[model samples]
Target: MIEVTNLSKSYGSTQALRGVSFRVESGEIIGLLGPNGAGKTTMMRVLTGYLQPDEGQVTVDGLDVLTDTLEVQKRIGYLPENAPLYPELSVQAYLKMIANLRQIPAADQPACLSEAVRATALTDHLTRPIGELSRGYRQRVGLAQAILHQPKLLICDEPTASLDPTQIVEVRRLIRRLARHSTVILSTHILSEVEATCDRVIILLNGEVKADARLADLSATTDAVLVLAEGAPDATKDLKALAGAENVEAYPTPDGHQYRVRGAGGVDLRPAIYELAHTRSWPLRELRRDVRTLETVFNELTTQVRRTSADTGEMKAGRRGSDQNPSASHLSERR
Candidate 1:
């Protein structure tokens, strides 16, 4: 439901996004992964039409974000790192106010408010002033407001930040529940949260898009193989001698041993391992490719990008001495 193409934005000398591009299909829980200054917040702002891009195009549900600014805003619900709230307003009043502000018709406001409250588990806390509620309850207030309009696109920046473990899980489940209808773009530093809630992730670095992929695909894309055998006594030594074998860890099991073998350059070590096991009369009970965790994939991609950037910076520094900001006229080219 959202498409961003070559979206570039900069602030004076600091570039926030550099030709970043990605697509979010409807009902997909997308985790926007990146370190500080990776342009995640900038991208979210551009998507919400709160900030215009210096370059590139963004469309939410087939409407251009730049041309249909107000329309896009109506369809997008943005919750910043710290939500903008009125502490003095009671939960009920705050939601009603947000409903009116979202332009929901007076006739439909009640149903919308009720649904938002029920979904966010704020029914019991509605009478309490926002300032009097605990941090979790306050976060619920933020979430309640964002979805009060039932927008098609929901952008949450650190929605669970500062929340306790129980609160974080509650908010995480709440986000998942909301994704049943709205497209979610979750930007948080918590990798485990991303793994738990997001179906896909887009990693950004140095104002650029580094990776965009489905969680399943990334998890399955690994060069490591798991080997479990009861009869393979000297399998570790033989496995290490195999070509392309990078690292082989052998741990003794009750019956025999379990081995984790990693290969180089996406090599398939299964065939060699199987052949050797057969030749050596090693009864292999389990031999399969290892699945990578989101953390592993994230670390690898970010590290590669940082290394390449460092190398390129050294070369560019030796030649140009510095970088230049885009002139307003230059930024206007995308317009």
Candidate 2:
């Protein structure tokens, strides 16, 4: 539904996007995953026809974004990081104003408004003033206006930026529902947002495309860890002889021995560990993967990119970003 090819953009000396290329299929919810200054917003702007790329081609549903600017805008619904809204206007009044601005015909306005309100679940709050609603409700108002015309493509930049945990979940769920009306592409640095909402993700780093794949395909490591109940017989010899086991290391835990089993790239060792435990009658307390998440893939790719740049003295230090997190998932929790 969307195509970007060798897209590059810059602000004077600083490049914001460099040869970024990707495609989005119809009805797919894609996450433009990146840290701050990773050109996510720039890409969003370019796609929405708000900013022209310094170089490259961008098309939406086979129409050129540059030449068919107004036509392209007609098929896109955009909700930026800070949604443009009027505090004094009632939700019903606000949506009416947007419909007029969108050039939605008078005869079709009520149906459009009704559909958008129902999709965003804003029916009950339609008569309330915008400022009187909570941030979550205000976000719904923003989304309602964006999709007021039922566009074919929806571009949301940081749709869940600053809401509380409950509000975040509410907004995320709403974005998912909006997918039924449009092909959604949302830009965010939050890994959990991508995990919870997106079918695929495009990772951006230093203004370059680092990785793009289905969310379920992201796996940073294939290693599995095994913890045997205390007093279980040593499996050091068995582990060495195990098929697909390239390396194994053992450490003593408080109540058991922990084994880190490594295998060839992309190999899954959890099933093997289970089978081994069953065959040897070894009492097992825990068997799990060492790591598997979009955050892991994000970190692994960013680290590799930074390392290569540093090795060649092409990387400068002190770039502000939340590239690494200390949380268990290596991502910030909504809390």
lDDT, model 2: 0.86
Q: State the lDDT at 223 in candidate 2.
A: 71
Model 2 lDDT per residue over 111-208, tens place: 99999999999999999999999999999999999999889999999998888999999999999998976799999877888889999999888789
Candidate 1 segments whose C-alpha is farther than 4 A from its true place: 225-268, 272-289, 309-335
lDDT per residue for candidate 1 within 1-335, as digits (tens), equals: 99999988889988888898889999899998766556778888899998989999999999999999999898988888888889999999999998888889999999999999999999999989999999988988998899998899999987887899999899999999998989999986567778889999987766777778899877665555545566556677888898989878766768667787877655778988888878887777878887667665565555466457677662111111114522111110110
Estimate TM-scores for all models.
Answer: 0.76, 0.77
Deviation from native of the Cα of residue 272 in model 2, angstroms: 12
Work out how many backbone clashes candidate 2 has.
0
